[model samples]
Target: MQGIELTLQDEAATIELGEDLALALKAGDCLALSGDLGAGKSTLARAFLRAMADDEALEVPSPTFTLVQTYDLRIPVSHFDLYRLADVSELDELGFDEALSDGICLVEWPENALAALPKSRLTATFSHLGDGRTVTIAGEAAALSRIERSLAIRAFLRERGYGHAKRRHLSGDASARAYERILVAGEPVRILMDSARHTPGPILQDGKYYQQLAHLAEDVIPFVAIDSDIRTKGFCAPEIYESDLDAGILLIEDLGSDGILDADGRPIAERYLESVRVLAHLHAQPVTRDISLGTITHHIPDFDRRAMKIETSLLLDWYLPWKRGEKASDTERTGYFAVWDQLIDLMASSEKKLLLRDFHSPNIIWRGERSGFERIGIIDFQDSMIGPTAYDVASITQDARVTIEPDLRDIMLSLYCAERNALGAFDETLFRRDWHLMSAQRNCKLVGIWVRLMQRDGKPFYMKHMPRTFSYLEVALQHEALAPLRDWCIKAGIL
Candidate 1:
């Protein structure tokens, strides 16, 4: 994870490094500048600080005499010049711990108080190399690993003829994957997807890890495969420019910023209608389980009983315990899975289609210039699988994040059924039945996921979506097929 000797050819190169580092940096990260006065440490520090601030003209006077300078920027930053400190004991008076805890810290002359500095911080030692500068980075394993990944991303871009592309940070998902916009001078903007190889967790089922059991794609192969197939089918999947499958890096075409949501962050009727139509069209098509990719074919996993059971078990494992403050015993766990197993099997009434996994607003890119279903640009489909078509319909319409109102949700269901039945030989009644079951299952899984995100990932932001998710679960469980599960929840006082 650690990188060594990265030579900066000029001031611009130094600035570029800072920009790239800015994408990798988070709050509570510390950058220890251990370099000679003329080695451009302050210049590099200022470059990073300015980039994070998104204000290149923001005056960043050297923290030489001021000792520490705080910025009211994105993810608050504290720049410290420890050169004049009499002893490490002065760190407490300067609020050093508080600065490190709250923001990204850039410490100049960190060698002066080396013993006081945390070992987890990245230390960049800069030295003169003719007119340029050479920076040798060293840090604790985790810090070094992150820096190494960022540097590898730099190399990935360079190899793809985007050596001078300006990297801009983009929003990340709940998953570990990271993304950035790579803007080249005279070329179309592209996305830099950092889908690092998933480090497998402990075994969960039949000697398989949780991701494996859940059919989650560990590398970028599924994404590349699914994207290629999606584009071939005339949808707007981002075109891949470069891919290092082993390294888990992809440079793909940017699909612009038109989302299915409006400026108010609410779902637009036409856009959402088109989204349902897009799903209907996809479900109607003859989709093969295997996706052709050059000489290698990617086989989309089945939404089998094991995966479904494991997913639903998340409710028992995380949400139920969190909500009730008491874990389910062996009898309850077995009974819970048995109920979902029967409910999920009811979804087999309709022919299976490739479940886009996350067919919701957040992942849907709206392209106004395109016509009909093609206007709905799909992303975040590496976890696609052969499953009941109703699953995706339930997913988007009964979205856990967005509250699509009851009337609108009804309209969406009708629109989807109209499109699917228009093709003839479609069973409207069966689809709705399966849709209800899928909605319940999906919402149940989501409640658990939200709780797990809060307790395990330290991401309590998803907790706000729980009430909506729980409400959807109630609507889904209203179906007679989900009575046992509903009764169990009521008995457990979770309903």
Candidate 2:
């Protein structure tokens, strides 16, 4: 009863619904199909399977004869035809439990095995409607909620004339945002940015939520504003073709897949240098903090001491407890903040710029054929802030995700300094010092982030990067201004 009802006006609509479900369903999900023999259940199942395979021509035979058919897929699927099932005990022999444990299950004639189905399984009951079919998908709240969002996105795209475009799921980053590539015949591919407004977490410190204290974007407005502003400045931020700001949906240009990393995932020297040049070009000019969004004005936040200190504290709060199997002591915490306090004070008068908070490989799209600064496509700047120029420089040079060797790191830094020098009075010494300070600060935050992602978010894939992050931190601490921090790290055992 806790679900949504949809009308499939034609076969195409039925297939679309199946595709939508493919996007919403995950491992351990069971989609129980209920309908008369000719009421389109098999049609829906075939569409779901083909979409999951990302191959339109994928063979999807009915499971009625075999009783069950399984396909090894991105998320493996098991199709079950339970009409021949005589009793609940037979479900066990059919590997029902194994199917549910490993991947998604699409069970036809679910009524025959009602007693054996998962209590949380989604049931799509289809019935003939005039010349079409009507389905009411009912399920537990969690699965139904994801389906609702998918339906909402479909409606949004329909309203914007992209209803018929094929949707291919793209891997999302650490945020709750989702992305899909839109494929339409004879049209340039566009990306659908499905970023619902962020839900605030419980207050963590100083009567503010973690997102509030950290200066993270709470909605898509910042992204839209930054995208518009950056394009005006001749940068390669995606062009928004259509947007529903209230719904947090946008149809934007698809910056192609080429990146600064090579096929082997290592950083390419030339591409990395071009990315460094992007930051140089961006930092050399002054830009306004106020961005206009037609009816609204979005002001970029300053990367204040509060935000910076809170970030560095993540190393204490998450990483230390994870590594040492205990919380950091009060003295250890005090000493860590003492070093950061001095570093922040030293950069109080430093020149500020529009820092693309994540100016690294993952966010940079290499536009090999494009001319000028447009050669680099910059995505993921929603968290943009007015911060010290060295922050962005540090983000790319000592990229947390990529291992930049000392020689190449120095070359990239030198290139950035040379570019800035050509533009105006640039003191390499002060910039390099700030770079080291910012690098250490960012790596400290990342070291904690990797652990937090594993422990709090159940994403252990990030933990593998811990060694590289620690190495980057060690490199940054060699700076003389960071001597106090280095000594503290040694005492705390993180160094």
Candidate 3:
């Protein structure tokens, strides 16, 4: 799992390797570089730093004289040149420990401090190979595994005629999936999805993994199936150009960068209304459960009582303890479940449609130039299921990332209801009830998720949305059906 060898034909190839490494390594990582003075160690380090900064023209002077240079970029980096006969004790004065604690470290002439470098550090050794250079990368199994997968993606893209395409990081979600935009010489932009198969966590219940119990997609089959199915039904899902199901990689159409939010991250009313209209058009008809591809059929999972309860219980399992600094008592826990069980029973009888579990602003793309449903580009529907239509409505109205003002939220809801009413057989009263119910349900899950993200996942940025979520929960709690849960939350000091 160690010692990956690559041959770089010229300076460009070496720079590309450094760019690829930037995507693989993270904070608290150290890459030890070793080579002769004229070798490509310093070149590779410079390229790596520039890539990390996302600036090819970023001035990165050699640290040979100063001995160390640090840049506080996205994932802060420290460049150290240790060829000055420096004693190992000099590292203590150079703040080596603090540097590694805060961000990544790249050491040239690591041989000078062989006893001081971390054993888990990745090592990249360069040597002259014919007219170019040969680089050997060795690292701990976990780090090497990341690099291996990244190289596999390069191979996949190369086989698909995008070998020379420039890769730029777009985003990474809460899941393991990462996305990159591909820029070719004279072709339309494309997207590369690196959804490596991630089977996370131990068996949490019923001898199944947590993802299995929650009906989350472990690989890319569900995404491919759902994307194909939705596109066929006139939705504007991205077109898939290439796929490696075994490797969990995809080269798909780029759906542009226009979203329903503005530069300040506020929701645009016109775009939000269009998104609602698109959903109304969709939920008016029954969705096919089993989607067929050329050789494989994917059956969409059901948002059954078990899955819903598992989600709702997160509020009890994480949020309550996190807020109150202790676990809920047995009696309080029993009362909470009793209320959710009743709510789920009521939702079980509502109209069912394909529910995009996360239909928020982050997953939506605004195609203003296109008309009708084509104006909305949908992504991140892999966890979609056959569930109550009101759920998706709630997801957008009370978006997790953006705040939808009260008047705009009402207008969006009215647009959806009016559209469905014109389509016939739509009970506005029943839909409103389910809307409130689902909103409360969704907000509960989000409150717990924000806390869980901070407490368990070491991501505290999501916690900034907690107050907004709590405010949304207050709106949902005004409903009479959620009175029991609302009272419980009030007593629990969360309402």
* Predicted structure with the largest lDDT when compared to the true one: 2
**Model 2 alpha-carbon miss at residue 199, Å:** 0.6
Off by over 4 Å in 2: none
**What's the true lDDT of residue 433 in model 2?**
86
TM-score result, candidate 1: 0.96
Residue 105: error of model 1 in Å?
0.5
Which tens-of-lDDT digit does each residue in 319-353 have in candidate 1? 98898889998988888878887786676666787
For all candidates in order, the CA lDDT equals 0.86, 0.90, 0.89
Tens digit of per-residue lDDT, candidate 2, span 324-426: 9999999888888988999899998777889989999999999999888889999999999998889899888888788889899989999999999999977
> Against the hidden true structure, what lDDT does model 3 obtain?
0.89
Could you tell me how far off, in angstroms, the CA of residue 362 lies in candidate 2 after the best superposition?
1.0
Task: Supply the global lDDT for candidate 2.
Answer: 0.90
- Candidates, ranked, lDDT: 2, 3, 1
lDDT for position 24 in model 3? 86
For candidate 1, list the clashing residue pairs, or say none: 1-144, 1-145
TM-score of each: 0.96, 0.97, 0.96
* C-alpha positional error of residue 279 in candidate 1 after TM-score superposition, expressed in Å: 1.1
